[model samples]
Target: MSAPRFALGATVRIAERTPPVHHRVPSYAKGQVGRIVRVCHEHGLPEAYIRGDGRPFQRLYRVRLDQKALWRDYAGAAGDTLDIEIFEPWLEPAE
Candidate 1:
């Protein structure tokens, strides 16, 4: 499928789905929205590398999400945020 490539500061949501095989997205980040801060170069899927099959390639990104948005109970500063390096397949345009 031709997924739209997001620009810097674009809003995106981590896919809330679970793949049958091993994946990189964390359970806590799923279904959450974040902003794309960096568009990383293409790389072999980490799961495939873990399986000794480093063949698949995809784009990666550094996404920034507000801490409070991610955790309702977050007690840190309102400006606090988290950055995650997520593969493109696990991301979707924020609806």
Candidate 2:
């Protein structure tokens, strides 16, 4: 199989399914639009989820989105943005 295609500055949609209970992924960000920034090397969830290390740093794609896309009509700077670490499974080709 070919390496999954993804690109920097590419638009992706976060799926609607809720994350595992107690996961670090935030609830508000579900089903949001974000631009893929980086495709980090992959690692197993079990190894990445080792306890006692504070936040679990799961292998994920770094995404950057405009604050307005995440929150409409908010009183934040127009240039404000949000950077979120989202697993590959959580994202799909937007539209």
Candidate 3:
């Protein structure tokens, strides 16, 4: 319920965390650098919802990442990118 931690166009990196439960983010995306393209919504945390924690709220963002950065075997165009919606907790300012 606080102000968003990141603004649009901000560069961020997905946190490389491996929790015991499955996270919405794909494993290949961990540690990837991306830009915050859109702010989605304040929504319930999936982990909390499943645990019957009554659901905590958090900001969600759409992150745009270079496709090549995601796969070593990527043969797509240089401009190719992938946009993924991720919760704020999964992101950090890019180093």
Report every candidate's CA lDDT.
Answer: 0.86, 0.71, 0.88
- Residue pairs of candidate 2 with colliding backbone atoms: none
lDDT of 1: 0.86
Provide the TM-score for each candidate, comma-separated.
0.84, 0.72, 0.91
Per-candidate RMSD, Å: 2.8, 4.6, 1.3
Badly placed stretches (over 4 Å) of model 3 are none
Candidate 1's displacement at residue 36, Å, is 0.4
For 1-95, candidate 1 gives per-residue lDDT tens digits of 23438888999999899877878888989989999999888778877787786666778899999999899899999999999999887889995
lDDT by residue for model 3 over 2-94, one digit each (tens)? 799999999999999888875688888899999999988888767666677636788999999998888899998989999998899999998
Name the regions of candidate 1 deviating beyond 4 angstroms. Answer: 1-4, 47-52
The number of clashing residue pairs in model 2 is 0
Deviation in Å, model 2, residue 46 alpha carbon: 6.8
- TM-score between model 2 and native: 0.72
